[model samples]
Target chain A: MELEFVDIRVERDYFLIQGAGIFAPGIHLVSGRVGSGKTTLAMIAAGLKTPDSGRVKRHGIGSVMLSMQFPEQHLTGSTLESEIASWHLQPCPVLALAGLPGREKDDPFSLSRGELKRLHLACILSRRFDLLILDEPFSALDCREKMATADRIGSIRAGITLIFTHENQHLPRVDYLWEIRESALEFLGSVPDALVGWKNKPSVLADLHKRGVYPKNLSTADILEAACRTHD
Target chain B: MQDARLRLLTVIILSVASFMSVAGALAAFIWWIIFTPGIRTIAKSPFALFFLGFTASVSAVIWLTGGDGISYLVRMAVILLLAFYAYTDRAPGDFLDLSVWLFGKKIGFDIGLAAEMSLQGMEVLSDEARRTRVAFRLKAIKFGFRSIAPSAGLMIYSQFARAEEQADLLAVRGYRGGGMVCPQFTRVKGDVIASTSAILPLIFAIMPVGDIFILLQ
Candidate 1:
């Protein structure tokens, strides 16, 4: 699917994503400082909010889903079983995928923050959407859970996937990079090409780049191979 | 101010006075104008503005329909001001404290805890309303009756979900129906003076001297 942003300007000039188009069949990572209107951009990408002056064009998209920052806000069911069932899929498989087995009768709200996020992410990611937008997906998850979430996101075959986050420690294999600079959306191009301009890139990438070895991908194996080649 | 009990008493007394007589309400209104957090706080608070606007609109409607708009407006203004004073610096679980003190352990604690939970629920509701609005805005949902029904339904369901979680937490913590708490009071000179002065409004309300409106006419 193709998503086109035509000079979008949000309220108070908070963010201006102008004349940029995203042709996506892969993962796209959006990064920015706190209060930099990353959420605003995400909302626009999901076609949730209207911009002050601009239009969004989506081509051949079946359905779109925007995963909100707060899991509680998007909770659709009272009981754990009901929440999973609300997705219109079998509850057992989804619950097991979230690592929450036999918790079908538990109240969704009674779950801890991490547990709740896991449940929500599992439910949301398991479904099929042409366009999927995740805002701060890694926030409440631990190291292991973060890796799990990242892998889960990578496995998605969605036409367009947009992830807005501040985490620079660990990231999924990104196909495209977009950042908000000085109240404007700057498309930093595809993964390896865009890594050069990523101000707050992962530590490993920065270290490898310092040693004159720019890896083709963000995966640990690729970075390690590049580092081994540099030594040889 | 240091003692929640004294603060509660002052609020109750003043609120009763304001509703009972035109003279008392007018006096309470003047007191609020002179004493309450300066005009700046009022201007900054959307709730304050909303209360003012709502009361004024009601008064306007009453006046247009040939009723005693001025008297009703004065009474409502005093009541709203009293509400602001009562809620301003309230700490969480204060109603629980007050109820337990008044009714004692078993029944008092239950009532107070319920009140405290209800107040917290209200805060959550308002916060969720704002967040829901933003979430909808992002999804290209307009603010209209059609959109509001589902939004309201979702919010209510979420609140219930949260309440269920709170109950579970309480159970895990070994909570019993009876709450045990030591009631502490800070009876400063100012508080004593304030509490004592509250009686004056009641006296004014009860006396044969009549309402200020009658003298004005």
Candidate 2:
């Protein structure tokens, strides 16, 4: 179960991606500045939109899921409980995981944006898919929630998962890293190695790297621990 | 009729004829089902069930008042037919073209633009609502009125937000409303005949057919 984008070129009026190719499994963290075609790449990779040239091929895929930036955009149930139920899973575990245990009977939209993001994450993560694409999964989330979401991403057993986000901080340990710069998708190889060349690396990581601290992990705690050790 | 102008005229004439007499209304309804889209298409519309219940209630009221319930039901059915026909037959930008052709440059274009936007908005709203429902289904939620209310609200809110953005986009493009578009129409072979047939129902209603039947009774 894998997704392959070979020499794909997607041209939009505002942005364009030319001659980009990616073939990978496991979690791939896609990062780029705003309007860098990250979401467009995710959509093309998820088979939501056709590339202008080249092709996208998925092999032996069972199910595919794409989570939009706005959690509310993916909401289809009237009540919180029904929304969880719609995922075809029990509401108890999902709600608890989402940190919205008692909001099952409440209107889904009545919750704040952060709450909705948590709920969407809980719902999408709970389901099993061959390929999962999350667009800006960290938006409207608190630091703690971001950490929790990163942990969840780390635990996913999906055949292939791609997270498209501009947020560099609090990203989980991903198998691979890719970025869109100047309308071209550049695969920067696996983690650690890829970290060396991330042009828009988060300030914390950049500071650590500048201080000669190549932390094994990017989580807040790990970076802090690495910084302290370097200081000592 | 394929032509929007001719179709609108037929809808008006038939609707007016429907209100005039029981015979005229029944003829219009029958004629619409036979010559236009037909009952199967109208029956499948989302609004069909609501109109069905409405017609039933109106028929019941007529019967309770010692009047012919069937006549009222027939008239209601004619209106529903018109609605179904308009919805099914309309194309994007056709209304704008028709309005411009009918009303000329200034006011006509504005009204047409408004109508076009409203129609497009409805289409977008419905498409988004369906996608949202599918999103629920993917999660395994059972779809029904109980589950649709809040989703409907979100869809509406999203549409409003999008409408504001669209307005901003138009403003940025220097749109101040008055414009010209080349009107296009696809004329079908039977458009003239069908439009001519619209007058027959009204004429049939104006005749003393109902009176003749009453005298015989």
Return the top candidate by DockQ.
2
Deviation (Å) of A35 in candidate 1? 3.1
- Model 2 chain B poorest 10 in a row by lDDT: B133-142
- Best model number under lDDT: 2
For candidate 1, what is the TM-score? 0.60
Clashing pairs in 1: A48-B138, A48-B139, A48-B140, A49-B138
Model 1, A7-71: lDDT tens per residue? 77777554355436665778888887777788888878877678878888898987888888878
lDDT of 2 by residue, A120-167 (tens): 899889887888899999999999999889888877765788989988
Question: Candidate 2 on B20-100: residue-level lDDT in tens?
Answer: 888888888877866786876665565566777888898999999999998888787777777788777788888899889
Worst 10 residues of 2 chain A by lDDT: A15-24
